[model samples]
Target chain A: MINIGVDLGGTTIKMALINEEGKMIDKWVIATNTIDNGKHIASEISKSILKKIRQFGLETSSVHGVGVGAPGFINLDTGFIYQAVNIGWKDYPFKAELEQLLGLPVIVDNDANMAALGEMWLGAGQGTRNLICVTLGTGVGAGIICDGKILHGVSGMAGEIGHITVIPRDGAACNCGKTGCLETVSSATGIRRMALDALDYIDSESILRTMFETKGDITAEDVFDCAERQDPLSSTVTEKAAYYLGYALGALAVTVNPEKIVIGGGVSHAGDALVKPLKKYFRHFSLPKIADSCSIDLAKLGNDAGVFGAAWLCMQK
Target chain B: MINIGVDLGGTTIKMALINEEGKMIDKWVIATNTIDNGKHIASEISKSILKKIRQFGLETSSVHGVGVGAPGFINLDTGFIYQAVNIGWKDYPFKAELEQLLGLPVIVDNDANMAALGEMWLGAGQGTRNLICVTLGTGVGAGIICDGKILHGVSGMAGEIGHITVIPRDGAACNCGKTGCLETVSSATGIRRMALDALDYIDSESILRTMFETKGDITAEDVFDCAERQDPLSSTVTEKAAYYLGYALGALAVTVNPEKIVIGGGVSHAGDALVKPLKKYFRHFSLPKIADSCSIDLAKLGNDAGVFGAAWLCMQK
Candidate 1:
């Protein structure tokens, strides 16, 4: 039997038909309709699923269940979304409504968690039962997999590693109303912020200064490009970002002691430029035993990680 | 059936006869014979177990197996001691040797892991499946229990929270060859060190100065006593120690998101004097949601936690 996986986001809704072995048989994406506070989302998802079933000439019985990776604090057992700031969802009975509309069992979890599960199942963390998957995008996010299971704490907020206070004093303010969070120094936005902050003190000969003068704003990509060329200012910014990220990972290494740490998201695309420095900081911050045991690697599945992980949720049940 | 639990430590060996319900039916202690490089330790343990069985008029067949909580990096599946620094054990076949000597199945794990398991089974973390148990004795040690199982990272070193870099720069040196670790500030030795350091900058009128002048050396207990009396120097020292500890715990709360944090060890005896200030620092450091969900409580089992946790290991198989 096959399973349906849904990667639900504020901008788009991506869906996939997955086989028992986690292979995606077919997939499609639809622009999200957030009209009327997303009241029609469940119906739209059901309609899409039915259209796909009819188009492929497959019976409903062929689909085992539907698993969704949603952006919010989800009640895994109840399928309730306590809050989703971007989607404007609050106390939404997501699972019950989706199950009713699709006439199939539905499972839902945090999107980052799904991405981690996806990596564990078919990406960088394959064959490792315990691991941590971190996404360094606009904000730093993480998902913890312990003994082949997602660790959902009492409130399904177990892997909020981004909010960890990396700089205890005089740190930048965070969106979460806190200061010195890992996200402040490690995320794509954070890297860009660091680059911008450095422009004032940077040497006039620096390429990053030239880029900032020409572009009005330097992105994390711009910072990486300049660093790759050995620009002192850009290299300093990247080094600091990598240090905070690696230090946070080191703290996690000693706490959960996962077999592997899978780094994902846009920032991780820097490849060796990011991981080489991260591994060094990780070793410096962790105990020798922990530093020697856990392997750090980049995520392989990218965006599809959510859908694959959603399908994994269906397979689990 | 009954299970035998051995809490092997540097100074003494504690043994317990436990029932299926996790209750300790009988218990005793013997001074650890670490002479001759600890070679005779296993045979001594077996002899003690045999003596207890005879004294209680119990049959050998009535005991299911033996569970040993040893101080070191233990290979849980193989019952091997990778390295126990205090006992001078290296690559010792702990389980096989003990099983052969006692004529029963044997299970082994790190002492801290056992203490955590013990607390989860019958102490402060009794009803919680996910929790972190920290011991703040001579050094800081931790045990992580996720979903009712001990989190033994790759090579069984998952819960080494002591070595997490709390002070990123200009922090004190730790025996682990790291700077600014939580143990360097929060452990018993760390607390005493802080107290001694405070003597230089402290006011001459402070009571701690008097105590130091009278005794020539102040213990961690002396610092706590002086703090209890609101002595300025001792209070400042305890506050700094508590802040570092709380900061480390806040990092763990965001990373692991355990339902509770059970603080064990000698320092925890300070009770509300320690917890009240620690809670304030934890709240200041963590995301509000995390600070609200994960509780910080004292460990209820104390030294007996190791023995109970060891018995829990035997019960698993």
Candidate 2:
């Protein structure tokens, strides 16, 4: 039987028809109509699902169920969206509404959790049951898989690794109103901020300074490019970011002790330059037992991880 | 049917006959007798089990199995003692030996993990399926319970929260060869060290200073006593230790996000003097979503947690 997967994001809603083997049969994306306080989102998703079924000439009996990975604190038991700041959804009965509209079983969870599950099922963590999947984009987000299940804490706030107090004191302020979170040091935005901060002290020979002078703003990719070329200022910034990222992973290693830690998102594309130094700091911080056993690898599926994970959720049910 | 629960420690072995409901029917303690390369330890435990069975006039079929909570790293799947430093067991086939002696099933796990299970089964964590049980004795050890199961990582070393590097830079050296580990700041030894360090700058009129001046070496209990009376130096030391502990818990709250954090061991006996400050600092460090749901409380079962947890292990089998 085929499963329908919905990856609900702030900008777009990506849907896919996934087979039992976790391969996508067909996929489509629609603009996230967040207007009207997201009132039409459930109906819009339902219409898209119906159209996809009709277009594929598939019977409802062939479809297993619908699984959604939404952005926010999700109540797995009720499929209620407690809060999705960007989508303006609060205490919305998303799962029940969509189930009623489509007359099918619906499973919903946090988007990052879906990505983690997706990676675990079909990507870097293929054989691992215990894993941690971290996404480093605008902010750092993580989904913890312990013994092959998502660790949704008491309030569905488990895996808030981004907000763990990394700096301990006098660090960058986070959107969460916390200081010195891992997100403030390890994300793409954090890397650029670090590069911008270094510009004031960097010498004229630094490529990072030249990029900032010419473009007015340096991207995280530019910083990685400069570091790859052995630019001193950029190397320093990348090392610092990698250090914090690795340090946070080390902390997680001792806490959850996952078999594998999968790193994903835009910043992870820096590849070896990012992972090499991160491993160095990880070894320095983790206990010997954990350091020796847990392997860190890049997420292989990229953006498709969410839909794949969403489909996996349906399969689990 | 009854289960035999063994709480193995460096100094003594506490054995109990626990019923299906987890109540201790009969209990006894014996010297650990770790001499002669620890070869006789298992035999002694086997002898005690047989004697208990005969004395109670119980048939072998009436006993479920044996469960042991041993110190140091354990290979849960194989029941191999990787290394119990004090017990002098390294890569020993502990479960096979015990099972052969008693002709019954045997299960073994880390002492801390067992305590966590015990607490969840019948103590402070009785109602919570997801919990973190932290023991703050000479060292800080934690057992992470997720969905009613102990989170044994790839190497069965998942709950080593003690070794999580809390002090990023130059902190106290830990026995694990790490600097600034949570154990260095949150454990009983750490609390005493913090109190001793405070002696250098503590005012002459402070009761902690007077205690230190008279006693030469103050105990953790003495520090707590002084703090209870509002002694400045003791209060400062407790607050510092509590801050580090709460900070570490805050990190755990986001990572594991257990339903409840049950604090046990020697230092936790300080009661409100410890938990109140810890909760305050935890709030300061955790995201409001996590801080609001996770409750930190003292462990209820105390020393009995290990035996109870061991019995619970047998019940699982």
Candidate 3:
């Protein structure tokens, strides 16, 4: 059977046509314009997905189901994206609209959750019944899978680990209008901000400053590169970010106690440069038993995780 | 059919014979001594349970299974209590020992988780599939239930909400060797500490001072009583404690997204004194959609929640 998986992001709509074994036969990426109406966007997604399926020489009737992964609060049972800040969506029935447009059943879920599901089926988390995936990029995203099932909480927001309060009283300003949220201290943005803060505290000439001076923006990636070269400032900033991130994961381990944690996204590309330090600090903070049960690894699927996870979802039923 | 449910605590072991519909047919409590060997204690429990069954005119063979709710890190699948701080237990297989003594199938789980499970099945959280039960006594205990099943993470250490870090960095000393845990700021002990802090910061002729001066120890109950009588110091302390507790719950809500949070134990007896203020602050700190999906209420089963939840566990498969 062929399943169509769509990953809807703020900037692009990526779709894949996959076989029963989760092998993507064909895929396409289209630039998404957020200014379009919800129905129009849904129609566009349908067209792109159909085009991809035809390009792959797959019959429409052969398609079992279509799954879409969105970046926000999505009610998995209801197939509604309650809210997606990046896309200006609020309680939009993307699944129903897309089903109408394509004349096929559609399943919708939070993108981060789908990514974790993808990893569980075909990436770093394969063969594990319990795992958590953390995506460290422009923003922090997390997905928790337990007992071979993705846990969709009462509001389908069971895996919002980024907002878990790591900083109790005060630390940094989070976009959620709260001070010292975990995202504020441990996300890619947080890591870059840490470098800027360290620059203010200590005068240092390094690769990060060069990037900021030239590109007008410094990312967590530039800091990782600098840290790899043994730059003290970048290393200190990245270490601090990893420390808090690990602490948050450690505390979360006490709460959720997953067997493995798969770290993904742009920042996770730094690999052990970030993970080794994170593992050290996570053990330092969590209870011995909980810390011992959890192991961290980088996500193996890269960009294909969305397609893999969304396909994995349809395959579950 | 009858099912024996036991709640094992430091000072006492409470047992009940629950009918299929969850009615308590017979109940008893016995003193539990830490000095007693685990095997002997298991024998005693089995004997007492048998005595109760005979007295209630129920045949021993009619009893389907035995369920035990214990404190500390437990292996639910293995029925082993790895650690119970209050009971001084370590790697004790109470289930296997008791099964040998009574010749009946036995199941064991974390006491707090069982309490939350009990509430989910028959108490305040009845009819709700996704619920979080928080027991706010000397320490904070939490049980997270999703999709009608207790989320017993990979290591059976899931739902240890008390140990989740609430403070951004570091604040007070916690029993878990970590500073600024949620229990440190939200439990009964936390309220007492906050009350003391308020007394030092605010200058006033307060009932709390008189009560504390007259009584050697200041209690959360005393502070609540003082606040009821319009003591400024007590109110400030309650507000401060409520604010942080609500903030932590709000952050937790974003991640867990439970449909309802059932609060129990000693401090929860304050009812609206805690819930009202907590709701106010939860709204201030929670992600908008998460806050909307969750409702905070008092747990109904009280001390019996453990046994009931354990009994419910028996009926599961």
Candidate 4:
């Protein structure tokens, strides 16, 4: 049987039809509108799925169910988007609306959680019962699987590793209104911000200065590139960010002690450049046994993780 | 039938005989000689258990099994003490030794993990599947329960909350050679140390100085008393410690999203003096829905949690 998978994001909605084997038989992407008129957006999502099904010459009856992965807090029981800041959604009955439009069974969960489920089923953590997936995008997103089950906690808000207090007393302010969250040091935007902050303190004899002048904006990529080119200031900034990110990961390891931690997202593109430093400092900060047993690896499946995981969720029930 | 429970600590070994109803039918305590041979300590524990059983009028055949709780890292699968610094134990086959002397099945686990299990089965978390137990004494210890099962990650070190870094950088040195560990800011020793450190910068008066002079040592109790009396310095120290601790709990809630958090240990005795501030800061730092559903309550089992949980462990399998 096939399942319909939807990857709901702030700017776009990606829909796919996946078979029991998790292969995407058909797919399409549509621009997402976050306006209060969610009915229009709901219709758009339905149309996207139906169009893909028709194009692939697949019968509607062949689909088993629909699974959605939304970016932000979701009530798994109610399928409610409790709050998604990026999409300006709050207490929205997402599943009800989508089901109303499509006339199908639907399960909705946190995006990172869905991605984690995907990894556990088909990606880096294929057979692992205890694993963690961390996505280092604009903001850090995490999914924790324990004993082969996703932990939704009491409010379905577990795996918010981004907000764990890396700097307790005083550090940079977070969008969560807290200071020194793990994301403030680990995310792509966080890395770029670190470079800009470092530019103020250190002499800017950096390749980043030249790149930024020409590119109009600096990215985490620019920072990593400059650091690799032996730019002292950029290396220091990247090292500092990696050090703290590792420290946060170390803290996370001590708390959950997952068997495998799969690091994903744009910044993970640096591969060993990011993970090497993370592993080094992670050991320094983590308990010896936990550090020794847990393996930190780059995430497989990339952006496809969301769609794959959503489909996997449908297959579960 | 009855079972024997032994809580092996660095300085004391507490043993109890528990009946089928989970009641302590008899109990005894003996000093532990850490510097002595391991077999001798095991013999003392066996002797203590026998004495407790004899006093309770229970025959050897009436005992189901033996359960022991030991501090520090433990291998649940092997029933070995991986490393226990204060107890001077490393890779010690304690359960095997105890079983040899007593001629009975023996089960062992980390002291805090078993304590939380004890609370989950018979105390504060009796009916809950997701609970976190934090013991705040000389050091902080945590035990996590998810979906009716204890979360003992791949290596049986899943709940090391004290070692997780609360502060990103430039915090106090932990005995484990790490900086900004939660134990450095939240333990009774941490709170008292904060009070002394704050005295160098602040000119606020405190009765704790005279109290400690006469008592020969200061403790979290003394700090709480001064805070209750509205001493500014003590209040600052306690509030700061509570805030950081609460912040970490808030961060932890986002990650674990537990149904309830049971606070135990000596410093927890400060009651509302600590909890009130902790709740305030926890809410400030946690995601809204998570902060609303999860609660911080005092551990009901007290020092007996270890014994009760140890007994319950044998009853389980």
Candidate 5:
């Protein structure tokens, strides 16, 4: 069956046609025009999807359904998006609007959750029923899958791993109106902030300081790159970030005891430099038994994970 | 339908016969004979159950099945107890042995998980599909119920909340071979230890000192009683313990986001003295969104939670 997956993001909308075996048959990317509070998003997506279907010479009857991953709090039962900040959509009837235009079944889930499901289907999760997929990008986010189902707590707010308290006292302020969140120390943004903070220290001779002087700022990538090159200052900053992230994951390990933890998004590109220390601290904090049963791996699907996960959502319905 | 729930512990074997609505129709308690490596436990339970069934004038058909809660690292699918240190059992086929002796189907699960399920069915959980029930006794234990099913991650160690590290550095040693675990500061054993440690401080005037001198050692109950009577030392210990427990729950709120958190066991008897401070700290540490959606309540089932939870296990099958 042909399933259409849509990864609706702020800057771009990624769409793909996936087969029954979860292989991508066709794909498309279009600039997201969030004009008018994203009022036209549904119509634009449907139009683009329909045109692509015709060009591919696939009959309408062959199409299974559409699955979408969008940012924000959602009513899973009703497919309603509540305050998706990046897309500027609030309380929009996303599922109904998309279904009305497409004339097919549709499923909507959080973008992070979609990524986790995608990884579970054919990525780092390797078909594990219990998994935690964390995206450490500009900010940190996580999707929890238990017993092969996305766990959406009371208000669709479960798996907000980034906001878990790590510092407890005198923590960096977060956009989520909290301090000491994992996002404030482990996200790419947090990593960059820590690097900048560390560079400001007296006589800290490092390439990161030179990078800051040249580029006016250092990125999470710059910090990881310097650490890989054995820059002392950069290594300290990366280890600190990994420490908190690892500790948080350890706490989560005891709570849910996932079979696998898939690390994704930008900061994950740091590769072994990130995973090594993260794994060490993760082992240090978690029970030996739990740590032994669980494996940590880099997310393999990359950007396409969202779309793949979105498509995987269709199978659940 | 009728189900027999068995709560197998080190000192006692609490059993209950319950109707379809989860109400205990009859109950009995017997000594847990740990002699002979507890090899005769299954037969002991089966014979007691048969005698009770006959006394109640019930036919074999009326007893749908038997569900048992045993301490140990269990294989849920096989119902095998890997090692129950207190029960002196190792690699015992609990379900098979019980089924053979009783001539009825048997389901076995971790004792802690059963308590959580029992609370979910008829206690503090109040029928919430997603809930966390923690038992703060000699050591801390937790049972996680997600979407109305017990969550046993990988190897039946999903809800090991007691092991989550709270101190992270230079904390107290734990029986789990960890340093500074939540159990080190939050269990009944932990509370007594802290109260004793605090009483050792110079120039401290408290009834606890008088009690400890006379009674040889203070119980967890003495700490709460003293704290209730406005003893400064005891109040500090209770609040400190509550702080760690609350912080752990805050982190868990972001992971599974249970609708309700049920605090039970010996420490829960402290009532408002324990919960009031725990709720304040829980709210302080958790994201406002998650903290608002979740409520903390005392476990209503008390000692009977195990039997009720064990019975709930039968219904799941």
Candidate 6:
């Protein structure tokens, strides 16, 4: 069956037409108009989807349904968004509005959950019933899948991996109002912060200093690039981030016993630079048996995971 | 239908005839024959079950199946005990042996997992689909129930909460050959060790000093008893254990977002003394939304959770 997957983000809405085998039939992106608390989001998305359908000469009858992943606390059954601060939505009947406009069944879940399903369905964790996808973006997020489905806890607050305290003592403050969360150490932003903090080290030599002096600031990519070039200060920063990320992943592995952990988000582009030390520290912190059985890998699907996951959600219904 | 539930332990084997509604029809106990690597256990268990059947004048047809809760690394599907050191079993075909002798279908799972299912079925976590049961006995063990089924992970290693590190620095070692594990602080033995170590505190006014001077050693119960009588040192020890437990549970809440967290085993007997401090710390560490949604309570079935869980397992099939 053909289905439409919508990935609603703050900057853009990614919509994809996916077929029965999960291949993308076509894909489109539309600006997320945030004016007036996103009142026009449903109409915009519906129009875009219909436009794509007509262009492909596909009848509305050929479309099975739509699945949308939004950044919010959502009601899994009714697809209601309790709140998505970035999108300026609260108590929005997301599914009903879209269904009314499109005249089809729709399924909704949190964006992180959708990405995890996408990874499990056809990416790094492909064919694995039990998996965890950790996204190291500007901030950290995780999606836990067990028994071939997402784990949404009582309040859809499960997979808040970034908020878990790795430094249970005095650590850097996080935007979430907590101190020393995993997000404060391992996210792309966290790596950049750590790199900037290391600039005053007593005896350190690094290319990052020159990069910072020239560019005004260094990114997480600069740290990985410097580390690969044998830059001591940047290597130290990467090692510390890897240590915490591995430790948290180790804790999660035993908590849910996932078969594979797929690292995604923009920061995962560091690839082996992140996965190598990550595997080392994850094994160091995990139970010996679990550390042996669970595989940690990099995500392959990149930005398309959400759309794939959204489509997969519609197929489930 | 009537079925038999078995709780296998190092000291004895507890076998109970449980009805379809989970009521215990009759119970029997037999010494665990750990002689020669538990070679006689299967035959002994079958003989005892047959004797109980004759006592009730029940035919073989009346019993539908048998479910056993064993302590060890188990293959849930095959019911193979990889190794249960205390019971001296290794690579044992538990299901086949029991089914061959009793002429009935049999299922087996780790004891902790069974206790969790039992709690979900008839104890504190009754009817809750997403639940976590943390058992604080001689060691810490956990059972994770999500989506109304036990999460076995990929290798039956899920729910090893005890092994999760709480103290990331120099701390006490655990039986699992790890340091700073939650098991080193939250288990019954851990509490006893903490109380003993606290006795050397200068200017301490705890009655625990007198108890240890007279009795030579103190149990965790003595620590709680002393605290109830307003002993400062003992109270401090209990508080510390409660803090670590609460912190770990809070992290776990956001990981899987269970509807309830059931604290069981010997340490849980401290009741409100443990739950109160635990709740405070749990809320302190957990996301406000998750803390508000999930409930932390004591286990109701005590030791009987194993047998009830075993029977519940049989009913599921």
Best by TM-score: 5
Model 4 CA lDDT for position B251? 72
Error of 3 at B253 (Å): 0.9
Clashing pairs in 5: none
Total clashes in model 4, counting residue pairs 3 or more apart in sequence or in different chains: 1
Structure candidate 1, residue pairs in collision:
none
| lDDT string, candidate 1, B150-251, tens digits | 878767887788888999899899999999999999998999998888897665688888988998998888888889999978888888888998899898
Q: CA lDDT of B239 in candidate 4?
A: 88
lDDT over C-alpha atoms for residue A285 of model 1: 92
TM-score of chain B of each: 0.97, 0.98, 0.96, 0.95, 0.98, 0.98
The stretch of ten residues in a row with the least summed lDDT in candidate 1 chain B is B196-205
Q: What is the lDDT of residue B264 in candidate 6?
A: 95
lDDT of 5 at B54: 97
Candidate 6 chain B least-lDDT 10 residues: B197-206
Q: How far is A256's C-alpha from truth in model 4 (Å)? A: 1.1
Candidate 3 lDDT over residue span A1-317, tens digit each: 98878888888888888888878788889887677544468878888877776776778788888888888777787788878878888879878888988987888888998899999888999888889999988778788887887888887878777777666565788887777777886788898888888877887687777777898887888889989988888888888888888877877787788999999998898877899999998887677778888889999999889977888787666
Instruction: State the lDDT of candidate 2 residue by residue for B20-88, as single tens digits.
Output: 988799999999988976889999999999999999999999999999999988888989998888989
State each model's C-alpha RMSD to the native: 1.5, 1.5, 2.9, 3.6, 1.1, 1.5
Candidate 5 wrong stretches, greater than 4 Å: none
**For model 6 chain A, the run of ten residues with the poorest summed lDDT:** A199-208
* lDDT agreement of model 4 with the native: 0.84
Off by over 4 Å in 3: A20-22, A33-35, A38-63, A83-92, A100-104, A167-173, A194-204, B33-35, B60-62, B168-170, B193-205
Candidate 4 residue lDDT tens string, A119-204: 88889988788999998998887999988888888777788888876766577888777778878877888888888877767765
Clashes of each: 0, 0, 4, 1, 0, 0
Off by over 4 Å in 1: none
| lDDT of every predicted structure (CA atoms) | 0.89, 0.91, 0.84, 0.84, 0.91, 0.90
What is the per-residue lDDT of model 4 for residues B1-317, given as tens digits with 9 covering 90 to 100?
88777888888988888876888877778998876544478887887777666676778888999888888778887788877877777778888888888888899988888889889888898888899999999999898988777888888888888887776569899877888888998999899888777765665556876676688777888899888998777788888888888877887898989989999999989888899999999888787777888888999989899989889888886
State residue B256's C-alpha deviation in candidate 4, in Å: 1.4
Span of 10 residues, lowest total lDDT, candidate 4 chain B = B197-206
Task: Give per-model TM-scores.
Answer: 0.97, 0.97, 0.91, 0.86, 0.99, 0.97
Regions more than 4 Å wrong, model 2 = A201-205, B201-205
